[model samples]
Target: MSSQTLNKIPLISLVGPPNSGKTTLFNYLSGKKFKTVNYPGSTVEYSISKILSKHAVNADILDSPGIISLIPSSPDEQLSVNTLYSHPKFGKPDIVAVTVDVSQLSRHLYLVKQLLESNFKVVVVLTMTDVLYKKGFDISENKLSSILNCKVVRVNGKTGKGIDSLLTVLKESLNEIEKDSAASLIKADKHHKTKLLESYSEIEKIEKEVLFETDQKSTNGKIDIQKINESIVVLNSAPKFLKADETSLKIDKFILHKFWGLIIFFLIMALTFTSIFWLAAPLMDLVNDGFSFLSENAFTLLGEGLIADLIANGLISGLGSVLVFLPQILILFLILGLLEDSGYLARGAMLIDKPLSKIGLNGKSFVPLLSGFACAIPAMMATRTITNKRERFLTIFIIPLMSCSARLPVYALLIAFLIPQETPWIGGLLLAAIYVFSITSSIIIAAIVNKFSNRLVKEKDNTSFILELPAYRMPKPMRVIQETIKNGKQYVVKAGPVILFLSLLIWILTTFPNYDPVVPVSPDVSPEQTEILKSNERMSTSYAAYLGKFIEPVMAPLGLDWRVGVSLIATFAAREVFVSSMALIFKITEEGDDMQNSILNSMREAKIGDSDQKLFTTATTAGLIVFFVFALQCLSTVAIAKKETGSWRIPVLQVVVFTALAYVFAFVTVNGLRAFGVN
Candidate 1:
């Protein structure tokens, strides 16, 4: 068949087993950069890319979930099936690109056989062909193509070898659109009928002619399997290898050695929180200052009314709120990435299994729970890794309680306001205490929920923590850079646009219909009296005023006035937006035209209530701290829950439960402090 020009092609779905370089090919074809996690099920969902052919036709290419077999008992396998049979959006694919690892042809061919049976126009894409010669294996591509009744294109997704030829084959196949007759010859039935028997016989003939046997074991493959087996065996051993490896100074010794491991874990956690607080502070201030400068300059250059205020308040402050925390987010991910790539995270999971077991969570729950700290959505998605349904659900349920980095801005702002920074250790202690509180509360809640729920716990004496600690090779520079770039891009792509819009919206709220009420400047009038009237006027007519009033009574017991309440409400959109909200409000309320100094001065003098009391009193600040500490105050988390659970009921319940607890706790803390005369 003559090749059709690339510019006029249809969709091609790339399917393969885990880690078979399917993603690499997708990246090459579509130019879409996807992060590759060091696990089998990295590509949980499908992603599409457009491959521009030399002739100008752009081909729609899809990279799908990794599946070991069509007959799947796991969620990942089921997801693959859904992708194949049901095109929820665009209907069925026009073509299928089946990737097979050349070295692991025997296992890889099983999936190819299944895909061929599905009746899609199959073009076999042989990936990792270099591994074949290295591993002393051989496959006759021409012979295999004849036997399977499909064109075989040898391509290396990694090295880009023979990619153009493969693309040409795809073009040729499109022109013909010939469905292989061999497809209808295989069925999923247990017993072989005439069609199935014929398909098997054909496959056997192809295997005999095309494949040459190899005696050499794959250096990486054997090591990986051996490590997995040893780790699993060690986990279930009678005496346990918990002490360490043969070095007498075992790696797991301090990492998972019960008492020492627990201590180190706590210390690592404490240091993580402390580092977030200290490192993020200076960067946050710089961002705030930078935004303030820009807002003031805009107001000065663009004049004093709506547009100026919008640029100053809405655009500058709102966007600044989200941007200020990027440093912290980067740092958090850096540490996490290192831990993950170094292969210590799984070991950490094993270390915590005994403690998790006490809460009706199995060892598998550790992966999800630890993942929750980064992002509850991914954490919830990770529940699929748990074999036990009860454990999976429990992990998802409790994941939101962990303080994801989104909540960091809210916590930092409130803590800095309420707690005295003069006492560094004291402030540090309080900050660390909050994380401890979060952990304690999550476990207790999980335990209570477990007791009430009737989810059956399947008991099996056979259990293991089998994981491959890939050789401690120096972390690949290109791989790390690639991942960081990929993750950073996703962050911007997924969360950036929403934040940009929200920032502009917030600026508009504070700046529009500017009310500049004149205060009498008589020498006889006291400064306090003048300040009081001006503050009242600002509060009555400002956008924050209207919002704060709506939630005033609900949070009255916590000593929050309309301003703080308004800030809290704004943050419900995204918790890290709190700082920007505060900055915006201050920009609107500033007496002078300068937004930066205006906000700083406003925050500095912010007091409690009427009667000469401050608006940002110690009690209210403490209350806000406690509230953020326990609140499930992130939309992203909720969205993630919905995605993971495949339902809204669980996420809704989480919102209600976490918010109620946060309010109650804050109210008690505030009132208790008042009663004790701490103010």
Candidate 2:
């Protein structure tokens, strides 16, 4: 917003401790789908949107990152602290909403107390009140408000229990807090840093008076709560000895068990990947046939020209290759969103924290690393949660090694050449092995980098891995669906156009300088054979072929010809483009439903340069698979890495190193497999 715009409307800044349901309340108030994963550091950056609500107020809401104290330790915290101090560009907020999880009120209110003492209008927004009984406590919101000298409201994010009341109070408070254009947010005297541990006593003393014991039937034989939002009463009447009421604690026991947790984590992943194939297969076929029908109609209508070929092969065919994977993308995001909201995502991180730390990585790296499997761009963004600069950079460097969904199309196409589609389970197993290998290789690389980093960087990065685990809750249906659709739209709107442009570029290069079918009539050659000769002659002399042959020398060691070599270069624009490039290169214009199968068969029958040897032997196919798994191909991922790290040097070096290593690995694989008599 401009300075004039900021001067007229009021700004309300939402600040709270991590995982305190601050973003959820922002979602309910603003009606935007900013992701709310059930862990700390989910909101690495702040979000701003016009207040979309029923209250008759013209204002903007700035959702800042969670901060424990006014003093900051990490980059993510510093960014939020910058806005709290009212950066000149963002302007000052009229009132600050400090969200606190009632279950962990004693720990969360430290920030609220600090904001109050800093001479800012503070409203204590209470979330997760449903889990009060689970935590063996109940809180009086009115008492806490009076004690803290601030307004308090209890709201349930899932149910929208008291959202209206919260908004109404915020509008009133906006007027009461006098407007200020002061450059500095904190007008009090300058101070020294007192660690969060020092404030524990004062925070607990205030908590004990307002928060009552939930284990007892009645606190001193009297039970009553003030009428703020009517959510202060005890939720569960059961007498419980455990910390969390019952179900969550029991569920946590097995999922968090040392031995069982590993099994459960792997089982969950196995089920997730199985569902991606079994569930999305039919949807993929539907999309494929739909595009095929469109292409056929377009071919008939346009009727044999460059426009027709561009529409049928370049546009429809190329888009179909990538869009066929949309179902799998949506399913992947849906399952991930469910995992995040159900709180199992955080536990999975905790369960594997020890093993990750053994490799000089933090548990905080788990979320970002898991996100890397979807797409490296967002995965690198998720690394903001890592507090230490050294660790965060290490996490970003290895993220590209994780096989993202963009590689799925490439993997699926090549695996068909190795394993028959008849025994699909074997192909599935092979696919699973690729994912496992990618993760294992990444861990090994991280270990080596960590060792070298420790020796090079003299200053010790002693930042501890601190995370607040959210209690297990049922994943909300609407939230999961919304997140899935949002991500699906993002992939289509952002990556779709790039894929189309590159596909068209490949088509133009392959189709130009047409070779006229002026072959001399031979008695032995049939009409079909003559037509095939004409098509092959035209393709061999095309621009793409010349480019492919130029790179053929480099690819010769892997037993690959110009056709396969060209596709390896094309996929770097975006990994899914490999299938489209191969489709266009092989002239598989009619992709009815077996587009991939057609490509696979053509690749099987393909011959090496002037030789009878098959191009796609087992050794060559395995080499290509390894090359794709380890290569840093996507430009978007590289751009994000630079933006996140604020250095072009790192991303440029990352691309060079991974690409070179991939070539060496592929070279080793092909020769080693050939030595084993596999071909």
Candidate 3:
């Protein structure tokens, strides 16, 4: 065959097993920083981008999902394997870059051998060499490359070590493929039909060949060790990163113990959840102050007209309320990201797997469930990583009960009134109790749903959990901050507009029919008192109040009145709006520390309709807390569920089922508590 330069740009496909740092390498080559998740199936779809590394030849690179073999075991694996062939849009790949984790070199090379036999140009990229080396095992790149009949390069994706060398090899491979472009493209067009090597003993033999010990003793390719050592590695790679890994091994030992592990996991979770409250308070206040400043400026600039009031109260305040959650969102993901990068999260998943399995989910569902504590929108997106459709749908269905950060304000406000401020620990304890109750209820409900769903729908769900833990490494501060900021932006982008529109709608609903900008106030009162009275009068006569009165009878069963009905309606757009709606109901514009105290005082003094008794009774507040825990209040979550499931039936079912459950549980709680004479 005559050699010729191709007219089209060369294509390269990146393939690797999960947690092999493949996405990190892809980010380097493509000049695109896609999130590198530590768990499997995060890269559920392929990402294509232009080759931007100066050392590499100009080409288009496709980063595919992690796969163990050419023969697919799951949907995501099939997507990865399919891209090795020539595509109508992608053309033929000049080279397939297989990222081989040196720690598990032998197993990774099986895929390399398969590609080599298929007559495709394959380059074995040795990553995590340091990870293996720290475990006292090192590889001979020349020895391994000679056996595989392909060029091999070791690269550190995080440090940019050996990346240029790897890129140069890709350049050479691209040139070699160009020599026989026509024939190569023809070969690439056909799919891989026969299965690849499946023999474990054969792989183990090869594992022994190229691996050596730093201290002159080697476990070879697979890290075989004493029972304790094997247990250490199994938990997460207990690398000899000095005495630190030794400490990790000891700590992991205790954490994996049957009794201590539960205590440890709960402590870790409590720390994570509590950080969302205390750690985010100062930053949340800053965000609130920032928005309040903007709202004031908007009102000042436009003067006291409907437009100014709408822009300030409806638009700015609306966005401010939802966006105030940005700090908590960032903090939550930051802590979780650090935990993931440190390898502890893998153990956390494993620890939780037993209970989850009882409810028909595996460790894979933990990430999404944990993420739901931040927001259901991203939590729902995280479900894509779950390969099983049923598990993903079920995870999404139960996510609302996780009590996301959106409900934090509602909880904080209600808890403030429910528990006296003088006894702060009681409030804290009660708050913690609510979260505990919610999580427990979710587990129970999930088990019930799983049982009933199995009877109604018969689908083959035989997929078992396969988790490969990465070596524990110190989390990079930059990576944690970057991921947190990325997720914060996503939260804002997803929920911002929805909040804005609904805020405008709610303002309109509470302002009109008569549409009066001003209401009569007592001339003898102070300015603040006059403004408060006018605000109260305006709300009392507004269209929202009329609707609230209409729905009051339905809500009364749970001991809630017209005001709570209006607030609940407002939160449907975004759950965080419940706080803002409550603030409006109480004649407050913001939920900062100073204003929160004022709102609490107002709520304490509040009466139901013409009655002299308090409205926010302890029993009613407890019922409200329980209601928020189970209710599908966030429409954004519903929309995302619709998007992920591709069915209206599921999302509708989620809303109906959760709302009914919330009503029932809340009614029971309120009545039950009153029967116990707690109030």
Candidate 4:
């Protein structure tokens, strides 16, 4: 914590639009990389990185959220604004580097102008210069700098051009930066702080002196999307029917076209989901196996004691649970990025708008709910975009019901263990059933909540949805590589510390009482089996076991014993935790320990029904599956909901409702399946 002992890092903020190559530049600047988290209010977060500059400056270069305007509407935009205006507790950024794309210069200039007016001593990093070069546009750098009254460094973050110059400029600017006079001209009004609009006269005067063009074609012939802006004003003021009619007419030909558009929409989502499952499977297997191996080695090296148990059971198993899901997490983010960058995501929202409206939720709900597949934390965070209190609350309330990526591991583990690969249809059907149940139940719950809650009653005025689709550019290889690393690494850094501690705690709980007092045994047995037996009993004596016992009575009718009960609780932390927790309880100690054999052996050996029958009948497994599918099993989600809603009420409601429904459903499923002799 001591600054004197710490590295004196010079922080630099990189700001830009989506796909502006700002992140690319940050990756090059700092050896570190970042992943996209949806802007704070949205489910997706952008990636960022930091590295030591060649100037011997420890540069913490931040890849900021994309912003379209200074007047913030999205969480990303607001975050960018906040980062710029506020000083971090450590210190203020030494330099602000605003990177802009040449193709989208007009839109990109909005942020640049605002930064200039904010009195921040800024260095302009002009990225995507290669695109400008290819397009035959030429401008004198000196002239451009004079026009803007600031130093402009034209650089390609990709090819490393002008990077050195930009760095030198940054170092110099950090020494004697002065506040620009233009800062006084723009008002800090939320409604309209169009810096470009306010500075147009000065911009025009400067342009005449500095601007030059080569064989570049005039951009005026390109479609002017400004009309869509005017349409939003009219739509916002119009009645619901008129607004609906206008929007439906605008999109009907394409969205609901008899030809390819609808087909394409469906294909995109289908492909995305399929890709997530396919790409992550092998990596997930590796994570699971690797963690198991690490745990065994640690336990073997450390010997039989509290720290060993902590390392093995608490740290290794718990961390393994979190780590196993990283691949899926990365795949989900990558797909989301592709969708967003390709411009298909907004269209998907529009495509589902009409249907979602019929369900009493807005089309915007689709994005958040679909995002739930990645992590419900961000799904709940996304409710800010909902605008309506009732709709927002409704979305937040039902989001946990969706099968989040955490749940995917649980489902995968369970289905693979119980259902055969040859009968994949059965497993697929179960997965699909859970999804269907979630969507249907969400709609029903939203309708019921809407009846009692006072929803925003204003007619939709903002109805026309003509989004600017970025050209179908192949997702840049460098961008994808940077993104994959950022998200993948954070999974370890952000979640790793917590899981490590949890693992230590679990180890302590499961490895105490070296000798078993409950069931007396002869002293002739070998040490290893004796240790395993004692460890097993100690597990029963652990605090986690007591917790399971406390919840067991409530869950008993649903067919779960204390072991299963403990796992269900662990899952609330993260669903994948259930696997490692179960592995710990059963005292299995090897990576790639045949999960199917382990589960079957443990369950078959478990006593029930007057010492003859096995405890884990098919009905019981079915009940467990049903419970996981229906239950709200993520703490991160509830935390995020609390953050987003500015209340504990909705997340509390979600926890209670989902828990109750899961119990009831499991109870019925176990009893009914048994009664029908299906088990």
- Distance from true location, Cα of 165 in model 4, Å: 3.1
Between prediction 2 and prediction 4, which has the larger lDDT?
A: 2
**TM-score, every prediction:** 0.76, 0.88, 0.83, 0.77
Q: What's the distance in Å from true for residue 49, model 2?
A: 2.2
Top TM-score hit: 2
Give the Cα lDDT of each candidate: 0.66, 0.77, 0.75, 0.64
- What TM-score would candidate 1 get against the native? 0.76
Q: Per-residue alpha-carbon lDDT of model 2 for 1-679, expressed as tens digits?
A: 2442556777888999877888788878778634332222266667777788565666778887778777776777777888876656657677789899887777788888778878777888999887875445688988988888889999998789998889888888876644544333464332444645556667766776787765443444655444211333222332121254467778878998878989999899888778877787678778867877787788789986678888988899778866977888788778888898888888877777788887777787887887677777667877877788777788898899977778887888888889976898898789889988988899898898778765423446585777766777788888778767867777777788888888888888888777364666799999867766776776788888999999999999988888877777887878888887887788654435457767777887788867899998999999999999888988888888899888886698789989998999999999999999987
Model 2 score (lDDT): 0.77
- What is the per-residue lDDT of model 4 for residues 275-362, given as tens digits with 9 covering 90 to 100? 7776777787787767667777886799866677667767766777777777887887777766655455666776777776665666
Angstrom error of the Cα, residue 487, model 4: value is 1.2
Give Cα distance to truth, residue 109, candidate 4, Å: 2.9
List, residue by residue over 531-557, the lDDT tens digit for candidate 3. 666677788888899999999999888
The lDDT of model 4 is 0.64
Sort by TM-score, best first: 2, 3, 4, 1
Shift of residue 375 alpha carbon in model 2, Å: 0.9
Off by over 4 Å in 1: 1-8, 33-41, 54-58, 74-76, 102-105, 126-157, 178-286, 331-371, 377-389, 418-432, 455-483, 493-514, 518-536, 586-604, 673-677
